[model samples]
Target: MGNTDKFEMIANIYDTSERIQIAKASSDAIREYLVEANSKNAIDFGCGTGLVGMNLLNDFNSMLFLDTSQNMINQIKQKISDFNIQNADTLCFDFEKEGLSDLRADYIFMAQVLLHISDVELVLSKLFDVLNEGGHLLIVDFDKNEKVVSDIVHNGFNQAKLTDIMTKIGYRNIQSKTFYNGSKIFMGHDASMFILDSQK
Candidate 1:
């Protein structure tokens, strides 16, 4: 099955898995660099089951959880009703097929989403276009690791190269830092994850 189908199959169990714990850690790391006051509207791209974005509900006035899997979006919608999250909503959108040309946000948060993308540069450019001026783009993904091999997902990313790409796409004040290291995380190998923060 494709990645979206795979995610759809896992949608029900996602929040109870170890991946959710890792996502919580990723969200905690994002909190350190996030300026809560500056984020009025945020988009959680590739938000599967809303693990990270749900925890960040207090930070933004409104949040849009976008994902390719309808099953995933269903889980997020359930959570929204369960928690009475009036400011949170969800959309099943595949950025690779349908672009975010009309949609905009004050902050765009992508956690562990970049590696699954086939065209990173194109998506980054689209994200830049969607962000308002002075808006922030927070990306959380695994660092470059040759130990992990995958035909579907990327092997991860090089910080310098990713920064360069963001810069070329008109993103400024770029900063990246390796925040989390987990054993047997990526493809059953030890991997380190980094957070890249930039402005549009």
Candidate 2:
């Protein structure tokens, strides 16, 4: 099954897994790097079950939870209602297919999302297009690990290589740092995760 389909099937149990702890760590890192003035509007691209975005609702004036799985979006919507989160909303969008030309945000975040995408450059280009000038793009994903294998997902990313891609895509002030190390997080293998902070 495709990653979207898999996520759709698992949406009910996704938030209950150990992955939610990782999302919490990612959200904490994002909070640390976020510029106070640039936190007006944010988009949590590939936001699954709103784990990370839900933790950051108070940081942004408005939050858009975008994902490909309808089930995932539904979970986020349910959370919004349950918490009475007025400034948060959800969108079921597959940027890989529909594109992001109509969207704009002051900050865009992707946690454990890029590795699943088949065309990283295409997604990065579209993210650049959607972000307002000087907006920030915060990405948290695993560092390169050959031990983690997957047919549907990229093994992970190299910080230097990712920085080069972001620079070529018109992002500035590119900076990345490995922030977490978890056992059996990726394909049952231990892996480290890095957070990339860049500006448009």
Runs of candidate 1 exceeding 4 Å displacement: 36-39
- Tell me model 1's lDDT, rounded to 2 decimals: 0.88
Report the Cα RMSD per candidate.
Answer: 1.6, 1.4
**Per-model lDDT:** 0.88, 0.90
lDDT of 2 by residue, 23-82 (tens): 889999989888883348999999989899988988999999999999999999898998
Residue 137's lDDT within candidate 2 is 93
- Highest TM-score, which number? 2
Model 2 scores worst on lDDT over the 10 consecutive residues at: 31-40
Encode model 1's per-residue lDDT on 90-138: one tens digit a residue: 9899888867668999889999899989989888888899999999999
- State in Å the error of residue 197, model 2: 0.3
Off by over 4 Å in 2: 37-39
